[model samples]
Target: MKKIKNKKIKLGISIGDLNGIGGEIALRTFEDERMLDFCTPIFFASAKTISFLLKHFDIDIKFQGIKTAAEALEGKVNIVNIFDDKAQIDFGVETKESGKYAIQSLKSAVKSLKMGEIDVLVTAPINKSNIQDDDFKFPGHTDYLNQELEGDSLMFMITESLKIGLLTDHVPVKDVAEKITVDLINKKYKTIYNTLLKDFGVEKPKIAFLGINPHVGDGGVIGQEDKEILIPTLEKIREKGDLAYGPYAADSFFGSGNYKNFDAIIAAYHDQGLIPFKTLSFGKGVNFTAGLDKIRTSPDHGTAFEIAGKGVADHNSFKEAVYTAISIFKKRKEFKKLTKDVLQKQKRRPASSRRGRFE
Candidate 1:
């Protein structure tokens, strides 16, 4: 595959559930003219829908409408008209129509991302219940992207101060214990380890794993999964020279400020990690889907149906998601360049000289 140049990364924006606050937060984010300097945003939604939103919110911003992602212009909010017909604006109601339009926007944006028309994607919030159909059977965006994209997906929730990765996201609490197998641990650990190096530029990442049970199964008195499953797996991981630590008590891990000591934390399930992460960085965190060949991010919070179209939804998280995607995209390019140069140098070296150096 050909590499896209780093200058003015094409950021694809998917307008999530129409009835939700997806449109509002997206528009609010790009209203600042300075954001155009970092990337050219392409909103995969109809021009009519965007116009309705602008008028409803009483926000003054002009956008250039286009039929395809190729026609996107720099320094202007560009909308790729995915549909010509107007979508009904129900404010806070969850209808089948809203779900249908949400998936349409998402599908269009993902297509552009796969074709290399967009360098990265920053998705708005989607209602998981509403946006389900024959085409999209996955629980959430990460699952769908995992199938569409190249590598194993890790749902990484990040902020400047804290970073958390889920071992099993979108899985029920009852099923989380069974999903924490040796293979799953190794796959997730490797993904996060490499992501830290290539995506976040961490030289040697220190990762902590939160326990599935309370107080890490209370030293096997409470449960044996941590003692039997997690302990053995972590020991094997350590033997391989990875900086993996802990089946630490999830309850006290964050309150004790131990999270600051590590590069990232891997939680056994969804709520175990997100609960603490949102508590700490609620409106500022970015949900980054790591370990994939393509880059995708979303706001930490979900579609606020209660606050939808109220003009009071906070756009900071969505804004941070865009910034995070851009930063990671640039970092990945730099990593590829550095690695490519090293490979070329190694290829030029004599075999006898390389053997002597290893000796």
Candidate 2:
């Protein structure tokens, strides 16, 4: 018998909420022996909590404390323990201790990512209201990435091919209209376009934009945003030689499987895109933070606080999230290589010859 080599993608994960499904799902996702072939998952949490989880769930895996990331084993479970001995976390309670631990884990994971210690990141769902305190005013992960990276970012839902991006996340209904601006729309559209082309390797990506008003305002019969904001944005994208289209009513657009017609859909509000997207893709969609410095993905579902300790919470989304992160990593790198090859070839070709090919 030959001894095969183990090539695994190193993953950095943040324990979302110790009291919720974050720990349980994290434990279960790594329980498989076959996982050693794909990626070496490095979880940033406390040693005590992870041990408690393994015992509580009867999960047969050991969490060894690795002092530094460079010491992580390639084919075994390695943990970077935060050593939070102060908190006695209950199974279902959300105390300040849980919040503090969650924040610390996230901060540690983000730092490791910045240092290029980890190639990709797969995160469990964190409770926004609890983990982030008064000084931390960001709404969720996307905003957290924006603040951390010091740049703009957007959240897009990924369930295989059907991608949906929100124009306004965590905003009230009254403010949704006010948030629709041309510059913001253009910024998000570019993210969607570049992600499809560069990440997914779509030569020319097609995107459909959803409207805020019912029936797309029937030519301003309801609201003017469809004609004023969305339509103009679509036109601009089309002019720039991208296959972008639509200011369709959110109702009919989804009913006809119109979402499948394009590579991604840009929604004008949070629920406008996410509700239908989650409905169609619940337990599968991977929440991708577009326009980030590095690849960051999370399971679309929440922490499942109600089913924290019951061992019934599904790890489907978490598995898919990890798989998606790995797939995106490979695909994007391949595309980047392809782009590099093409550009080098073009630069080496004669100007007249390159113009002839375009012509």
Candidate 3:
């Protein structure tokens, strides 16, 4: 990880579908002056689109248009125009033009992130179906980002009291069983474990693994994957010194309030994890992409096409996503400092010495 010298971090944002609630919530989050105290905001979108939304919503905030992210000023909302073409916004409608520009905004933000021009990336919701083409063929943001960073990314849904990670993201239920292999389990577990330790400041996190089938396949009566796959893989993980337990049945795990006992929980598929998470923390959950080289976060909800331009969409989840990204960024920096101290101390020791100490 590279050291950041500036106390005020720069937040890079991607405008999702222009027709959706992405632009609305982003403007709402930065409306408060208190937000400027934590980070400088730079949005990757067209100034014209923002102005159109401001007038449509009757919002009265002035935005500074900049040609590059480097020119962002303190306490000002800087908009980096990625596209020059004009696309009309049809409220509560889906169009190919919106998807095209959404991809452009995201691509620009990703390039800036790789160049170290931004500290963290906050993506708005995009229509998965409309955003697909030859170059973009992923199921969702997590898949696209993982490929871009060349890192194993986990879709971790976060709230004030809960954190849930998915083993199979944006996959069909019919194919979830075949994808839950030993190698897949090992890779996801390692990613989640390392992220918990380094990103979330958990020294030794206790994680729970929810079973795939109901009643854990009832010991092969319903299915045999749990007995053949999960039980044995969990044993191997435990042997490697990670605090992991469960093949717990999904129904009773959250229904009985047992999720509060662990630091994080992992599910077998997308809906298996997200359905419960959204139900419990609908308007306040933040989707944090863990295991990437740089920090990225988004609201747990998706593009609200039906409610677009209604001026009734909630900004609470998007606001929470910003707060979570800042918190994780600070935590990771602290972790790096602690590791650097240990390395420095070791370098000063005698050459003949053979000693080690655990923190």
The candidate maximizing lDDT is 1
lDDT of 3 by residue, 1-359 (tens): 99977658999999999989998998889888789899999999878888888888887778899998888888888899877966689877889888988899998998898888888999999999889998899888888888888578999998868999988998878999999998988888888888888888888989999998898999999889999999899999888777899989998899899999998999999988999999999999999999888899999888999999999989999999999999999999998999889779888988678454222
Global CA lDDT of candidate 1, please?
Answer: 0.91
- Residues 1-359, candidate 1, lDDT per residue (tens digit)? 99986568899999999899989999999888899999999999998999999998887788999888988998889999988689898989999889889999999999999999999999998889988888889898999999989999999999988999999999988988888988999889889999999999998899999998888998789888899989899999889777899989998899999999999999999999999999999999999999899999999988899999899999999999999999999999999998788778878998776521100
Which regions of candidate 3 are displaced past 4 Å? 1-6, 347-359
lDDT of model 2, residue 239: 83
Query: How many clashes in candidate 3?
Result: 0
Summing lDDT over every window of 10 consecutive residues in candidate 1, give the lowest-scoring window. Answer: 350-359
Model 2 local distance difference test score: 0.81
Lowest-lDDT window of 10 residues in candidate 3? 350-359
Off by over 4 Å in 1: 1-6, 348-359
Instruction: Report the Cα lDDT for residue 339, model 1.
Output: 79
Query: Which parts of model 2 are misplaced by more than 4 Å?
Result: 1-7, 350-359
For each candidate, the alpha-carbon lDDT, in order, equals: 0.91, 0.81, 0.89
TM-score of 2: 0.93
Going through the candidates in the order shown, the clash numbers are 0, 0, 0
